[model samples]
Target: MKLATYNVNGVNGRLDVLLRWLDEASPDVVCLQELKTPDARFPLKEIEKAGYGAVWQGQKSWNGVAILGRGRKPILTRRSLPGDPDDLHSRYIEAAVEGMVIGCLYLPNGNPSPGPKFDYKLEWFERLARHAAELLALDVPVVLAGDYNVIPTALDVYKPERWAEDALFRTEVRDAYKQIVDQGWTDAIRRLNPDARIYTFWDYVRNAYGRDAGLRLDHLLLSPSVAGRLRSAGVDRHVRGWQHTSDHAPVWVELSDD
Candidate 1:
């Protein structure tokens, strides 16, 4: 199956670009982030018309997440992350699709280090790690996919030195990412193309895409059982060049049928 993840940035604003990509790519399962719309305005009609049934958790003008299953309804598993009840951001959603447990997330973009936001970012990562360990214990075919908002390593960003002080590239953030991956999850893209300078996101500023100044912030991490099925993985880089498109391009992995 072709399983993909995309941070739409704004579901309604970029509806056209999304639909176009859906038609062109036709992934069997999709994990979407940054819907940036409230639940009431999720545009279910438009998405259904495009031949995919979806389950989404949305928030107005900010973080949101969803999972789409082609020709089938995604069985809703969980709507929010488990660690906090007061944390009311729509950053995560999970579902069962095509015999796999799919977790879609939009991790916090903690800017301005040495502050509350950055602390929250680390807190959230730890919560996610705790929950991820639970999922690993289940030993099912699981895929945790989304816009992680983390430049995992110096190799992931265009200029490591320039982003040294940035929250996304900070040492703490990268270490958190590593701890999660160390918990028996495979970084699908990196596993396949270890030496390649692959990127899944580019800023819509200063001709970043043109200059190839990008970051691999979006990721699809697979469990051991599913990792063995990983046949191929790639980024739809050209889609980022589309007019009025999101800063993030789609990232995907093709898994062999069980």
Candidate 2:
């Protein structure tokens, strides 16, 4: 089975691009982030027509997340991250598909470091870390996939020095990610292509896509059991060049059948 994660930027605004890609790539399951629309405006008909049954949490003009299963319905598990009942951003959605638990998340961007937004980012990361640990303890196969909005190392971004002050590349954020991975989850893409500079997102401004200037923000982390099933992992970089496409491309991993 192939499981993929993509930050669609805006599901409503780019439905056409999303449909077209779905037809071409045909991932068995997909975790989508940044729907940028409300639940009522999610275009369920369009997505269902493309052969995916989905469970989504959406917000207006900003964060949202969804999980889609091809030829099947994703059994809803949780719609919001734990330990943040007061937090209202639509950034997380979880489900069960094909015997595996899938958690889709859109971590806060936390732009402009040394500020409240950055503080919130760190807080959110900590919450995620705790939840991730709980998930790991379950000992059931899980795929944590989505736009983490973090660059774990200099190798993840094209210009390390330029992003030093950026929240995504800051030491604190990277360390949080490391803490989660250290809980025994495997970073699929990095495990598959250890020495390559693989990336999933490009800035909309500055012709970043054209220049192949991008960041490896989207990730698929497999629990130890699921990691053992990993067959291949890759980014559909060419998809980012499509007209009206998202700034982020699709990243997927193929796993052996159970």
lDDT (Cα, 0-100) at 206 in candidate 1:
96
Across 19-125, the per-residue lDDT of candidate 1 in tens digits comes to 99999999999999999999999989999999999999999999999999999989999999998999999999999997899999999989989799999999999
Give, for candidate 2, the lowest lDDT window spanning 10 residues. Answer: 206-215
lDDT of each: 0.95, 0.95
lDDT of 1 at 243: 92
Q: What digit string (tens of lDDT, one per residue) describes model 2 on residues 222-249?
A: 9999999999999999999999899999
Model 2's alpha-carbon lDDT is 0.95
Error of 1 at 13 (Å): 0.4
